[model samples]
Target: MRTRFPLILLLNAAGVALFMSWYLPENHGLWSTLDLAIFHFFNQGLSADNLGYAWFLAIINNRAFDGCALLAMGGLMLSFWLKEDPDGRRRIVVIGLVMLLAAVIINQLAQNLIPVTRSSPSVSVPGVHRVRDFIAFSTKDGSRDSFPGDHGMMLLIFASFMLRYFGRRAFLISLVIFVAFAFPRVMIGAHWFTDIAVGSLTAVLIGVPWVLLTPVSDKLIGLFARNLPHFTKMNRAIK
Candidate 1:
């Protein structure tokens, strides 16, 4: 079951990419209304003091989250090599590759649903000096057409995996990071409220299946043992 978690994640990610590609831009009215409400809600009492939070949120709403997701994948791969577990490492690498491929395919499909538009000087709302703020505003100008933020999806993916491998603490930390990172996109007009909502949901849809598929520790151990030689060579190269 544990062995299947990565595969499940990949499948779900593919589904989300497909959904976003198929439906978006055409439903801009609904997306705009939702984004406006959420934007105003978060805007209340927001100020420069929470700039750090704003910065993190911006990262999650933008392509920066992609970088973080890739980093997490690298870390997982390194863990397998360090453990000298070839089967384990292979599974992780395979899952990561699948997820990436799905992302590319989905991206291409989504491009047809919503073409990327150039950024204009749009509205400037006070107390929203971040990427999310821009995304929220972009909804009005049609500059922010991406229905779901990929960054949020990746963050959730990382968080879900951490919860499975580590503990509740890791889960909590990842959750906080995910929220923080996602908020800025809405605040700055980079994405609509609906985009964030769907992005987050997309993560859950992918993550739950992954959890169900992955087996517990014992099976993982057996699988690792079976591919020990490959892992050993990889580890030696790392050293």
Candidate 2:
């Protein structure tokens, strides 16, 4: 933890630098160009002639499919839960609860504190293919207010927490979950590339390090574990 202080400062500095780089008026063209290129690359697959691809997009963007992403995350956490001893399992539960609290707080801060106000590329960009235009399903293809993406931020927080608590293997799996789940929004044009790459990533870089890299998160988790004896007692049957 002592050695991580420098990294925490570095990450926070990088976050500030990244956000400023995108926010400045002079850099808008460069970032916008990158955003459009990535958006078109993924959204180009939405063609009236490609029913298979349309269906694929529909399934992933559907609200129901979002449940699958949540389930995958839950499954990953449960894998750790099952491997731990009684006290360890209690700590795991406390970690999950702490993670949820942290995610909610961070998301609200990003949404309200950030000055960005941009619509989804699907709605703002001209002459782009839409998923609903091809498929009759009720899938999300655009958003009126798509700035720092909440979905991607949440996934990133989960991945970072995994790395801090669990080993690198868990972190790797969480990374896959982050990409697999977060990319759908970009692929379908519901979010711009910067929304995740610049916006969400920036938020995580600054916010997560302050908690994970310091003793703050561990202290909070320990406090929860101490007070929430019922949760710890439930694991008594395990060993």
Q: TM-scores across all candidates?
A: 0.47, 0.92
TM-score leader: 2
Q: How would you encode candidate 2's per-residue C-alpha lDDT over 1-239 as one tens digit per residue?
A: 54388898899999989998899857476898999899888888778788898788778989998899899989998998998887888788899999999999999998999899889999999998888887789888899988899999999999999999997999999999989988899989999989998899999998999888888898899899878758445577665
What are the per-residue Cα lDDT tens digits for candidate 1 across 1-239?
A: 43675577677778577446435657354655665677666554335667565554544545655456466556644554567554655655544444454444444443444433323112333434444443342222214344555555556655665565546775676677677665555565555555556644554565445443555333544555555456557788999
CA shift of 222, model 1, Å? 8.9
Error of 2 at 79 (Å): 1.6
Worst 10 residues of 1 by lDDT: 134-143
Clashing pairs in model 2, backbone N/Cα/C closer than 3 A: none
What local distance difference test score does each model get? Answer: 0.52, 0.89
- Which portions of model 2 show Cα errors greater than 4 Å? 1-5, 229-239
- Cα deviation in Å at residue 156, candidate 2? 0.5
